[model samples]
Target: MKKNKNLLEVPNINSSDAQLKKIIYKVEDNIFNRFFNSFSKSEYLCVCSGGTTSSCARDNFITLDLRKEYDHIHLEKEKNLIKIGGGVIMKDLMNFLGSQNKIFPTGLSKLPGAGYLLTGGISPLSRRYGLAIDNIETIKGYLGNGTFISLEKNNLSSDQKLLWEGFKGAAPFLAIITEIGLKTFQAHPIQIIEGFINDNELSKIINLAEGFPENLSLQWIYAQDIYIYILAEIRNDLDKEITKKYLNKLENFSSLKIKTYENYNQINFFPKELDLFELNKNNHSEVISLLGEDLKERIQIFIKCMKEIIRSKPNNSCYVASQQLGGKTKEIDPKSSFFIHRKSTWKPWIYASWKKDDLKEKEIVLNWMNESWEKLKIFFPKIHLAQIHNHLNSHEEEVYLSFEERLSELKTLKNICDPESILPPL
Candidate 1:
């Protein structure tokens, strides 16, 4: 079960190769109780960390290509903090957070799985420090009843009541979260603007980025051309030349142009010399996170969920992105299971990642993103809450609710932590 062209490798297993499988060799300490009871019957005992992300406590776990178990270890980081090795790999945690000049809300291609971008919420300074599971304050590893605690973020609700068992997007089945104490930042060092447009002043550049403010950090990519990234957070040094007057106000309101400015701490943010994680693009992309609050009824619930995602494709393309939940992301308190969108407005995704094995055309792109969340429940009386599996064709996984009690406590926490559901094959 060890195959890899490059799911983005970041190995570590030595002691002179004492047969490393699905890695988690914690240098003795009572042999971590025989590797946690041989990983509770091993249906999938992964710790695979290197972008594509893994540590499947049981998603029927299968990801064993430990790059012949590479033994490249060298740890040490500071400037706010970092302590990696949950199989580390977003371009080696951006060359160790740009050698501690620091930065961490990760994503924007350094290859995914910075713990699948902080336990699958979102990042890239998620509208400036919000999700990345609340900038995790600690993690440490091994669980499946073989115990080895150390969670943090004020004891993730008593460690999800002594270790999460499963469901609503089962945190890959809780535990093997090894070494993720991140929470760093301070690398702005000035300059980082990008632009390109194909036409249609994209609704007055999304209305001057919804009336820009809060030290700007904007994006709106339609891929293949129609991208715009303007991020500025100089923290004085003479306002770093006011980012060239915001790149001359995005070249006087768009029409295709300019790119690059350097100093997002000098780029090279990861995607190591090519080989993009062996692109076997079996299509995937359907993320929605607009917790609603009438932006003209969220643009009429996005044109009625864009006519069911343009009839679920005949070559489709989508990506909405508004981002900015207000300084420090709604200052927590949405019930705080790390990040349950206290007011998450704008984050539409819906891609069409080609590579069909025709499982009914990938269930018509997940049934057209579950019929755009059932036409966003006819603008669900202007929604307000709901988290975890943030709607990607919902079985409605909750973290805190409002959509009628997160679909009945996410179906009783998936019938008491995955009653035989073995997750995966989503």
Candidate 2:
């Protein structure tokens, strides 16, 4: 394949040294089929929806950029469902769904693309409604062997049924999704309570949140300071009183702020200091996400280890943050998707970063991230394959941990669907 020197660079959210040999834009049926048939088997292949995952492109790989061509969003009111193209991001999806008085499970930040849904999207709202994958009703994509496939929940052959199960949580390894159909819920009134607290209060909050109803979820971050955020969906006056009572039980909170929003898109989950725009731009970062049960008795020891990790931070951006995930998320059957760790109550991610092109700082920060993961692994035994790290040494281990007993089955499907290994390796 000849390189397209004039083609604009793939704008990935996570800045990395990985380079693309050529970028194919406007991937219509003709272009996609032609490219898929023409590329040599030795050439690596990947897709860029919102340009977030590291595995989207490797050194000299041919990348398909979906941002321009596959961004259509349509709502099917009769079924209360929405169909979004591969290129759509969380912000656009939320804003569009909000206008229609509908909601979907999206992450705390709004920039991730289809990969978020493909990797089993976890949101504060996920505690009530299920994971993003659980909402998928239809998927249209090309399998690794250059065959166009469209599968719906209601109609599927045995092979397609197996492919459907794999697409839910292990899509990137199976095919290139061009569009997805998702079930949307009626938008509801929501409230947010945010405050900064010390280590002691953090433990207290975690314990208190463990017993919270499905409508309430907790997300906490330990950066320069510890910040706790609570998301409550108000179905009635009772929920409001219950949220207030929980707040009253807390001992101390700095800069406590409470606000209610009429819909999902109207809410801002992060503080001004940790702006999403700033975090995405002008920085190179890596993240490793973990799934674990409630800390409970291990809260104190976990906190101690966390404090040490925070104190030894390589930079201001390196920190640990966790989100609550148990309630409705656990209701789904384990066999339904590749997300086997449904028993998890918390999803904590270790993040490390350095200035772009700062190789020395990159080495130091990556070391810190791995070391921090080593200390916290005992508490968080399962890994979450949220962000792809195929280029890193932990890729195989993370993939295995993400899908333990199911790995062998997924591999068998990989051989049948992706004999040439066109998609990311299993």
Q: lDDT per prediction?
A: 0.45, 0.83
Top candidate (lDDT): 2
> Candidate 1 lDDT, tens digit per residue, 1-426?
335322223321111112334343343355334443454443434444452421222232334322233323243443375666555656666666676666666655564443453443444356556666666666665444344656655556753642332211234444445566666776765345555554355445554555554456555544333455556666675555655665676776544444443335345421324322223333433343444432442543454455444545533333333333444565665544423435644444433433344566556656655555456544432222222242233533323323343344444544444333332211
TM-score of each: 0.30, 0.93
Find the candidate with the highest TM-score and give its number: 2
lDDT of 2 by residue, 50-155 (tens): 7766666666777777878899999999998899998898889999998898899898978789999999999989999989999999999887776788889889
Note the clash tally of each candidate. Answer: 3, 0
**Clashing pairs in model 1?**
66-69, 113-116, 283-353
lDDT for 362 (candidate 1): 59
* Candidate 1 off by > 4 Å: 1-42, 46-79, 82-103, 108-114, 117-139, 142-175, 186-219, 223-227, 249-251, 254-350, 353-358, 363-426
